[model samples]
Target: MLDRVITISREFGSGGRELGMKLSEKLEIPFYDKELISLTAQETNMSVTEFLNYYESIPVTEQSLEPPLYTSFSPLYEIPISDQVFLAQSRVIKSLAEKGPCIIVGRCADRVLEDSINLFIYAGIEHRIERIISLNKDLDPQLVENKIRETDRKRKDYYQYYTGCEWGKAQNYHLCLDSGLAGVEGCYQAVLSYLGHCI
Candidate 1:
């Protein structure tokens, strides 16, 4: 049977979102990326800005020390805000997957969807730096590189914190594509071909 859900986890500036959009168009399925933020905000009765702040902010313990040691006395509400947002989004991802075939970009969708086809997209640091600089012409090259590194680190940590699995590992995904080598369109086509063969 055709896989109804495709989950893409990508490195910063790897064009994975672009590839996901292309695949959605070719496959005639809905694509979700930032749209999940809106859905999550609505579900939690929080504004988009508030949701983003919670979503992007890593827990304090995760930054400066080892994972926190929570005592049995701690209540569920005492959980880190980032973890709460992740759990909320996980619910949204699962609900969307149950709806039918769709393309979900990031938000740990691969880990959340039990039957989805998971793809990891990544590129070299140099390639990512160049891509970020090209997209943001006004920003300094060094600044762009720093931003890329920081964003990638945050994403990696977030994925690992939630899933207890290393992000971007080939073994964690069904297919891993190098966007630097394949380009966006090529990556999309490769995923489509792979899905065809598997389905």
Candidate 2:
């Protein structure tokens, strides 16, 4: 049986990927993040760009924009093609879980593998703009703020639309982290400690 499955979810510029990678090394488990999307694209015969365009963004339904009053001619309410692709992604995630313990990052993976011994971690910073600036030296504050906000919004909408749950809620995860507080290695150690205790 698989020992555990770790899902690292994050706000934009939260260093979740870095944390996931380090944790994977410490735990000696495979890590899946962008690879999940790439694998799904290969299985579905869709280009990565095409697959990402629809599912990676905020679903139109969740936005504050006014809904179309009439559906006579519009197919807006119909499921986007990415939903089908996500089904494929979910299958791949399950397959990996069956293979053995692993760490998965951001594809609604926590919800996808909710039945397993799951460890859900979220990383964010109180001063997101400054954190982004520090992490990415060349980017200006305005651009970083806009980019961070847009990416987080997309992730939030995607998780809510796909899993029917609010994104970034503490209840959705086993542990929540602030990179500014824990730093990458500290966050990784926390996850290790929890996994050691639980798994």
Candidate 3:
């Protein structure tokens, strides 16, 4: 068994989620994706709807340039629901990491775990749109293209808002792969080969 957690950050419509699942199955380890939302909801006593509403989003508060200082906050004070949801998810992330090695995708997971294998997956816009359309046959291709760009923007903003780091930067990840180039299984094998060297 591997001794480290793997966190995957990817652009919308990238096959990163599928890649993460493949790795989890190959490694015989647990995987966290949408499952995180339910766990976080239970942890915070928030409804799943509420969790999904605030999941991986930046609240529109112009309070400060930095992430809220969890250290100085008073128990008596109330924080925004978005911030509260983020904090809850963070706690759930830490708790899961402490339990055992696993694969965590999205939700700025790369920055949450102290010791983890951080991976960033991206693809060309055309490739992304194609992938989405293939999976979602009822959706319009043009709308899929637009959603890809908009969702990526939101992801970038959320990552920057919480971590103060640029999302999808090569330097931030241990390994970066272009899913559009090699496809999902190819990327999975690449990750396996990379992991063979490290763990």
Candidate 4:
């Protein structure tokens, strides 16, 4: 079922966003990544920077802070900024999905929109380190690896927190590709092949 939507959930430095744009072009569909942040900002009258920081993250509760016993009763203001941003982004994602087919990267679009083709891109740690260095020269390899793991952990926690599904689990996605093994060109071809079979 080509639902006219593709959601890419990926580990940091996995080239997932790049693959999303590439697929978007080949499929002649709109691609949304950072554009989602800007759109959410406009819809919520919030700053793009705010969404950038909190969109996919679960807010940290202070020491001794208690979890809400009755979340439905709490006013929106009582909600954490992270939750607010997620709600705004979810609204934007669903609205966009309704308009037409598109490729949405990150921001938990896979979980937010039902029946969309979900793909998760990931690579080995060493491969990710090299990829990260290729894009950003002059970074220390050790630090780059650290950051990559950190970001992936954050994403995993955030996804699980919101969706109760483990991140990067094969069962949670329609397709899981190791971009490190299959270069972008190869991954792109695989996606086309998958879609061809689906149709």
Candidate 5:
């Protein structure tokens, strides 16, 4: 009965990566995150950085945005380097899931595997300045907070463009967690328990 797949989408500063890693270890399954990005790069014969840039935002034309037409770009317009990477990565993800159970982090995995169990995590302190300072000892709190905000904006924009869904919206996932509330280890266990029930 080990035919379940788990997809985790998270906000910036959340310990989603850590949670995915821990859960993978506990479940004894392959975990994919940035590694999937790298693998996509390899499969598509594109550089990792190039794939990352195209990963989320494919260019759209002005004509497509017209009020009357409200037309969307042809699927080919989404065929830039990163979009192709996503296709390759998605194929890999499907192959992995079909082969057995696995955990995927980010890369719009929830959307890619819409039928699979999806969990979204958002871990942010009300005061990001403090969280940044705690997470990165070398960086100043103010700078870290600024970085977090900027990074989060990019992630949101990317997700919206690629998945046609708002990032961090609770409705997008089966479970939405706050790492700051659950703590990293607790979140890990929560995911495991969630999978147990899902199976």
Candidate 6:
């Protein structure tokens, strides 16, 4: 049996990816984040750009289990592009979990992998904005804030559309950490400590 799998879902500007990478290194396990996009593209024989476009988008038809009051139609709708991408990625995630322990970041791995430790990482908007500004010092603060809001909105929509659950809801995850409060290193240590006790 696979010993342990950790899935992290994060707010757009949160340090979840950094924490995940650090935790993976500390635990000596493989890590999947942007790497998942490449793997899924290879598996589906689709271009990376195509996968990136539909990476976390949901089909309009799947906006709700029940029909919506109004529906917008698109050529891609017929192809179910988002569904195809998600299914391909889902297969890859399951395969990786079955192979052994690993850390998966984003792409809804928490929903794809059974018996995995699911963590939701979030930070206050002010903290997120500050982090983004620090990383991209040349960018305007307003632009950075707008970008963060848009990315987080897309992530939330994609996760909810696919999983039928609200993103960042504490109830949906095994643990919820405020990366803003703990910082990346502190959060990594906390996750390690939790894993040590649980697994």
Best by lDDT: 3
Question: Candidate 4: TM-score?
Answer: 0.89
Worst 10 residues of 6 by lDDT: 67-76
Q: After superposing candidate 6, which stretches have Cα over 4 Å from the reference?
A: 61-79
> Which number leads on TM-score?
3
| Per-residue alpha-carbon lDDT of candidate 1 for residues 1-199, written as tens digits (9 for 90 to 100) | 4657999999989998888888888888999999998898886678887888887455775453344332222354666766666667777888888889999999878888788899999999888878777777787878877888899999998788667789988999999999888777788888878998885
lDDT of 5 at 112: 69
Reference-based TM-score of each model: 0.88, 0.82, 0.94, 0.89, 0.80, 0.88
lDDT of 4 by residue, 72-175 (tens): 33466777777777777787889899999999999888988887999999999999999989988999999998999899999988787777778988999998
Model 4, C-alpha of 25: deviation from truth (Å): 0.5
Clashing pairs in 1: none
Q: How many clashes would you count in candidate 2?
A: 0
Clashes per model (N, Cα, C within 3 A): 0, 0, 0, 0, 0, 0
Model 3 Cα lDDT, one tens digit per residue, 1-199:
5899999999898888899899999999999998998898998786787667877777786664457643324452366667777777888888899999999999887887778999999999999988888887899989898888899999898898888889988999999999998998889999999999995
lDDT of 6 at 2: 31
Per-model lDDT: 0.81, 0.71, 0.85, 0.83, 0.70, 0.81
Question: How many Å off is the CA of 1 in candidate 4?
Answer: 10
Task: Give the CA lDDT, 0 to 100, for residue 90 in model 1.
Answer: 78
lDDT accuracy of residue 45 in candidate 1:
73
